[model samples]
Target: MSHDFDLNSPENIADPYPSYARLRTEAPIYHSADPDLWIISRYDDVRAVLRDPDRFSSDVGGLESDPFNPGLEMPRWLTGLLSRISAVRVLLTSDPPDHTILRRKVSRAFTPRRMAAWEPRIREVTTRLVDDMLAADHPADLVHDLAAPLPTTVIAELLGVPTERNDDFKRWSDNLINGLLTGGPRIPMVRSAIAISWFFLRTIRRRRRDPGEDLISLLITGEGDEALSQWELITFCILLLAAGLETTTNLIANAMLAIFDRPVLRQQLCANPELAAAVVAETLRFDNPAQGLMRVTRTEVTLSDITIPAGAYVIPLIGSANRDPDRWADPDEFLLHRPNLGEHLAFGSGIHYCIGNALARIEATAALEEIARRLPDMAPAGTPTRITSPVLRGLRSQPITFTRTKIPAR
Candidate 1:
């Protein structure tokens, strides 16, 4: 079986699912090019590793054995420079008890009550964004008009950043995240680290002076040692910005593409607003924002009769898992009526499940529903440009031409 995976290749980055399917069937655990990291494409194997973090460590040293470690790709001096900031603020990169503490501390801020209370605000924001897009002209690129700003605005609101400065925050957040996803030298990464640290420290100082009703302010006064450490504060802020920005950004873009791919489904969705959630879930499964994640083994483990040595890098193909034959029925097809849609690992599983899953769902649902309702005539304006990054999958720009709808007067 062919094992070469040119992650940089435009073809692979744009639609690697077909390749992933081939690998999952022919080589469940195989090494790929560029550091020859071992990837687990089968749902069972990937799930096992994700669930057992003890055996498959999430630590950096563990990453040394992985094929795609930046440190391995960088010069010694550059690697040393990048090592200054190794702390992971969010739950995704941590493991076990520590992960539990940090997650619990922030989980309070994501309660059902909190989400429900924000529904009206979400709807208002969605409506305002749709109105703005209409003003821009019908068939606007969803990425720039709706998907990008919606989450950034929400994240800024959460962090207590003044709405006036939200634009700057969004720019900085995009730079920081793009740096991480696109493999490269450590300079951009270092700069991102500095920007994040500065942003959080400044925010913390302000919150101390005059606390507000926001996540950052609550974080400033939250009880217990689990209160985000200074380092965690910076990483968390960056995490919030990046996760909030990219995940939903790709989701909305990918959802739009999926709808456009199948005009029948698009028509069905445009006709019914309530089916948005189901459509969103199917979209997630169909073309997830995140493509894959890396894991390092702490000890030798057996997956699918293959013995992976301790410290080997494991790539969990999320795209493959969503379409795993052992899991979903008619794995290749998109079925809105599919039962147990929530079981899909689009947000992942175990301790590292996405912290922003609910928020992402809300954003996708709101954006898609509003678009379907307000701009039923919307269609792809031109060839969409997919972003180049193995970790993220979505259009960098999706130009669309559509018949503009007039907003009703207040």
Candidate 2:
């Protein structure tokens, strides 16, 4: 299919669903130059790429430029440095035995028992955030006050960081994550990465010497066949902090962003707080936090008669797949009560599925239920702004107002 598909265009970044619709219909396995990638947009095709890790390798690093914007390509040495960070090849970026070992080393931290133990604290944090938002007279920004802080606090607590250092941790995560979406070694990101890496290394070393009952301590204290190296621990901390903070924040903010404009939906949520889970499920399908993830072809692979060469970058558009007409009834509409809603690829699939998804769900569900319970009449005070990244998707700011004001809880 000869079509003009620019994955990084500002229009696509702002709202890529239209272009996604076109891709799924006309070219299921479309390839584009500039930022050269084999874009897989169909539900089944994207699922296949995700399921078969052997043929589609996840050991992707050395990304030179914004896969969406080729103009921002970095210098050769800069790209080489960025590639080393990518080359760490642990967890999501690593494949097979390495990934298996790394995942196993840290999997205990996210056990159902641990999460259930953490639920009360999650609710406590959520209620405090919502209360503070409600107590304020002027409109509150969900992204800043509630959504961001809730996850940031929980993840910090999980990692055994002092709550006083949450802002520092968040700033560090923000810079690194923004750079990740852009790719390569931008000078600012490089500097920030160095600072963040140094911070993590120092913290890891300290925790290893004096281990605590935190996830970082758990990763650092591994002393058997699956023991993670120092660098691996550093990488794990970075991934856990970045993923846990941003994704849950995005999930809560995105769900509320959708509900803010739709009064009926808001009313429904207020009417039945149990529907908060349903709201979360639909938001993930409608406007997920991440649109796509990159994978390299282990060998030449074919989908829809299009042969992708070995080592080529394959992008499975999760947002596009979630909206595929073949898989969804009204692919465009953000309707709740979706029967097959649980099947969406927002959390991804297979070995690399989001390790923090269970936590994200717990956080978002708690945030939503509390928001619905507390600010039943919350409405948009101004336009909500979305984060501008080719890979990540969520609101950067969500200003909102509510009719009822409750006394702030201590």
Candidate 3:
């Protein structure tokens, strides 16, 4: 397959959805120019593959990636770390039995009842943040002031990390996530990972000595806590922090961007309180924060008339699938009244459906509601700066101007 698709190009990073759509329509499952993997787009194909762990694999080591191919010029330390840590992390990057086990352990901390318990706290924090933003100035960067902090705060509280430690968490997550790009001991990435890893190790040990109601503490004191080895605990905490912070942060930013981009839809959302869920669902479909996830085929299998060999890499384009024209009507248009919004693959589907979905939804919804209530006339002040990662889609900065300089405290 000789074609043009630049994964690292600045243009693609800024807006890959157009390319994803073209791929989905022309070749739903086709070999990439790199020839190392088979890229899968379209809603049915990606969702079906993600749903079946039997045919597809999520094992980090089993993944058919060559972040360190023979002549790639990749960083040595980064490759080494990738080869080592890939197999040790939590359920997100693992498969069946192990995935099930780790997910079960952490699942207790985020049950439906627990999510209900978190609602009040989420609202309180959101309101307080909005109050502070309003007090600061009218022309505020919503991405910095509202979108970023809300998720970070919620994730920190959930993990029992102190509010003061949020900067450390953000810094570490940014480095670690971006590190995956340069191939292993990417200095900043490794340093940040080591720092966070050490912090989690110390915190887990403290929890073991003096347990609390937080998720980390629960992981240390859960029913399977006795069976969990030390490495598992540390890896689990690291995975939690990575997903907990990054996913929700992007979700807020992406949702806000989608709403604000369409003035009519924004007006509808601001006017209709009951239709918030629909708006959120449409936002997820329109510009999903989690653009895609990589999977490996365990055996030679056929998907959508394309043959993928065993050990072949599979990139499921979530953002593309959410907008697949076959599955959605007027897929490109942002409609808050869209009926099939829940079917979107924003939180993913099947076993790997985000464990933090409820929390993310709560945090995102709170942000939108608060923004509508406090800064109804907030408008983008400049072109938003997008985060440069194919896997995670979001803005690095979004400057905005609100209607009033002084926001009321409700």
Candidate 4:
């Protein structure tokens, strides 16, 4: 407890589970000094913060999170303008009625039936991607060939946008996500955000005239009550694009990495490909993609009898919460059949649960199953790179070699 719980420390970023264990034991409501925030590492306490947005308003609190604007260097005027906006601008940075309305507008995006409609597309993309990856089989970078593009491609198709523009999406997505995670230059990501927003605005206008089955068109055609204003529509589209891409990309990459050094686990998955879901589930728990989400405290609050002052920043670490010793046995191990797996906060909980949860599950599952079947001997080719982030965790590049097997027909 005497040592600082440095969330972004090199050691913590390398392997936060140990520090997280110490946090849960020594300071359940630990506060970090560098960025000035309180961290809630225990499961019950984290769940309480996420589900209770009243005392911890995501609107004002969420704005300070400044996730999109890395280093949070916003002009005074822009910060002032955010309040007068018609609705909360972004889903990830909004709370209550506004957040509620925004989320509800696109809630049906990944429904069971809708997912069934897209299941074939998911499999097709996964198969084709895997085939393409295996064709270049010797020491392929899974992050490049497969994980990075699959979700973005599906999202593009889902939005009725052209996949040929994927290069632009990739560039924009990288700048935006990297900016937030790494505290890198904000100008590039801001430019990327503008470019993507402009693209979505034009697409939304087009969809209004000629509706299609894609998510954007569906949102365009949404009736009263669920109708999205121009601002809301643009924000929602950006959220879907960013969230859909990064979360699943990281999930698949992390899941594959979990089994990378463990040959027994890889071979186990090879024999029982159906355990793909379990692999994804345990990866989420073992190394969830979304490491932490920020919230600002509206009023004073207490956890484990420790007080968090009003207007303070709070981070309920999803990565830390899942691995809290109080919650699971052998908390660090990546067991595919960990009981009560759904309890993990990978997709989060309450009204803000990820809209793409089912899509991520199925997409990652499909990716895993096909890889197991085709590249059953997949192994790490070299040192895999970890993303240097306190809030997101996954490999940036993973060199993997695998046996060439005939691509299976769906």
Q: What is the number of backbone collisions in each predicted candidate, taken in the order shown?
A: 2, 0, 5, 0
Local accuracy by lDDT, each model: 0.75, 0.80, 0.75, 0.79
Which residue pairs show collisions in model 4?
none
Q: Which candidate is the best by TM-score?
A: 4
* Model 3 / residue 115 / CA error / Å: 1.8
Scored by Cα lDDT, where does model 1 land? 0.75
* Error of model 3, residue 9, in angstroms: 3.7
Summing lDDT over every window of 10 consecutive residues in candidate 3, give the lowest-scoring window: 67-76
Total backbone clashes of candidate 2, pairs 3 or more residues apart or in separate chains: 0
Per-candidate TM-scores read 0.91, 0.91, 0.89, 0.92
lDDT string for model 3 (1-410, tens) is 33776454677788887787778877888686564667788899989988989888876454334422222343334324544754464567777787787777777877878987998999999998888877774568877787777877777787788767878987886677556532333678878978988988888888889888887776677454444556677776666666766677777777778777778877877786445666666777888888787777889998888788988778888888988999999988887667777888988899988888888888888888777767778888899987766767887788988766555645
- Can you give the lDDT of residue 323 in candidate 2? 96
Residue 39, candidate 1: alpha-carbon lDDT:
78
Order the candidate numbers by lDDT, best to worst.
2, 4, 1, 3
Which of the predicted structures, 3 or 4, would earn the higher lDDT when compared with the native?
A: 4
TM-score of 1: 0.91
Q: Which digits, one per residue and each the tens of the lDDT, describe model 4 over residues 151-171?
A: 878887887877678779778
Tell me how far the alpha carbon of residue 46 in candidate 2 is from the true structure, in angstroms, after superposition: 0.2
TM-score sort, best first: 4, 2, 1, 3
Question: For model 1, what is the error of residue 272's alpha carbon versus the real structure, in angstroms, after optimal superposition?
Answer: 0.8
Q: Supply candidate 2's per-residue lDDT for 120.
A: 91
